[model samples]
Target: MFTIGLTDHLEGPPDRPSGEIFGEVADLVQLADRLGVRYAWFSEHHAHAHQGHLPTPLLLALHLAGQTQRIRLGTAIICLNLHHPLDVAEQVAVADVLTTGRMAVGFGSGSTPEESALFGSVVADDRERQTRFSEALRVIRSAWSGDWSGNVPHAFSVPPHRTLPVPAADLPGRCWVAVNSLGSARIAGDLGFNILFSHLRTPEQYRDYCAAYRAAGGEGLVAANRPVFVGPDDATAFARAEPALRTLWRRFRQEGKIPAETTEPANPEDLCGHPINFIVGGPETVARKLCELHEQSPFDVANVEVRWAGLSHERVCDSLRRLMEDVVPRIANAKSLTGRMPR
Candidate 1:
């Protein structure tokens, strides 16, 4: 059956204590666990003007581990090419142990050049980035399995013992790769990792990518992230979302990062006009659209990014609660129009 989850985005600056946000997020995860949401994925970003916070998702996961019991915690997409593979392995291994084996590591060749520069990453060509990422994944998986034969020294090794924690036998799984372009999707398919397509393309594109992955013998969960906000009234939801949505688009346009042919709004208020840009509606509307998308694709998880630019934290949380209460149960329990939900 399909499950629902949230992708955490801790906005603002890194100097600000994440603990402030963590309190709220902890509450959200607790609610999600009670609501039967399967995963809570946190993203890693850096060196952005708007407080490019959350430098370490693994740390956040560790903190959440103390607060949550059943819901899986993960790095939505940890730019694996940035750090030494051994370091990544050690950190994730500890998180897995802390959470009692409830961890999913999602990796990607990050999109923004600014972030790459900040991390002192090589900024290699896409092919090379993919190659390095694949190699790192191998190293990380080997380290986690405690069966490494390579001469690579453990970065945090003790005199006679390695410091890394060994994950329990029931560890949820290894890393998932976030695929935006078709090339990455194909690589993810061939390599057999979980896939996360975070609203980077249309539903049709996602379906095609999923088909390719399955055809290539890839397995494990396939998930997507979509921006969704549900409220008691559609007008209130849209009104509340206007400012943040505008700011997000403005920043993207000023940076020349807007997708091809996607025009910048003359005013931030008009940002919602961009079709399929964001999902704003009440329960039934949101549920129908989610079910339709699932019917058309093979998504085992649907992660809704409920937090956006203009909406207040309270509003975002309320929207998510409503979604969990109204939308998720309907979609999770109902059979897809085609047949049973994708497992």
Candidate 2:
């Protein structure tokens, strides 16, 4: 079965007054849990005024752990290069316990140059960054296994100590790497970790990544992050999303972060330009498109980003509710639906 999850964005209303976004997010998580979504992933961005709303996803995930029962909570891509590996491992391990094993950690080499500078760190070149990221994963996995030995040094002078109250025997968490390029996916596969392909590439690009993962002898969950919105009517959905969508693309372009597209289309259909970038429409339409994409790549999970560009909390929540209550069930019932199936 394919898993369905929401990606939480803490930024609030773009042009209207709305209450706290994160507070609404907590409510959204509960709704998703009740509606039977499989997971909820939160992002990590620091010091980007417009985007760094959620700097502490772990803290937020802990709060979500209390509010949710069955849905898995995860970091979409935590900036592992900015913090000590042991510190991240400790926090994630505790979160896993709190979530009772329903946790997935997706690590990435930090993307934004501004975020890196604000964190007072140099963004390593791709090669160096990938190496550090891979090593950090090894360290984190070792820490979780409670097998601290070998090249790992023991602080004999400090005092003999284990990390802390481990979770119950049955509660074990899985880890994933958020990859943007084929090389990143291959590295993730080589490490035997799950892959979380960011929603910045085309379906063709992801197909190649998935093929490489299989070829590399990696077997685990593979998912992609895609923006999703399902409204009762197509016209209403597109009308509401178009302005904000344009603003979003413009902002990314201003920051020189637009994806591999040559030019931005004046129309909504051309918005993503890349096939796998975003999913926007009514439930059935979006479902059909998603299924078509799934037929090509066959992802095990789909992380839906329902909140983006300051959409109203109510609007975002309503869209999510519609997706969970309406679109999700249809997608679940349709056996032949392809692309990234929901879990």
- Pick the TM-score winner: 2
Clashes of 1: 4
What's the lDDT for all of these models? 0.72, 0.73
Q: List the residue pairs that clash in candidate 1.
A: 12-51, 13-51, 244-309, 244-310
lDDT of 2 by residue, 1-343 (tens): 4678777656643443334667778888898899888878888876544555778888888888888788888888788887777778888888887777887777887657777787687887888777777677666666766656555533211222465555444332267888787667877788788888767777787889888887876777788668887778787888777766776777677766765454777787677544326677888877776777677777888778887774676787888887877776777778896443333
220-249: candidate 1 lDDT, tens digit per residue: 678877888887766776677767777767
Deviation from native of the Cα of residue 63 in model 1, angstroms: 0.6
Residue 319 CA error for candidate 1 (Å)?
Answer: 0.5
Off by over 4 Å in 1: 13-19, 49-51, 151-164, 169-174, 259-276, 337-343
RMSD vs true structure, all candidates: 3.8, 3.6
Those runs of model 2 whose alpha carbons end farther than 4 Å from true positions after fitting are: 12-19, 152-161, 167-173, 258-266, 338-343
Q: How well does each candidate superpose onto the true structure, as a TM-score?
A: 0.85, 0.87
Candidate 2 lDDT score at position 298 = 78
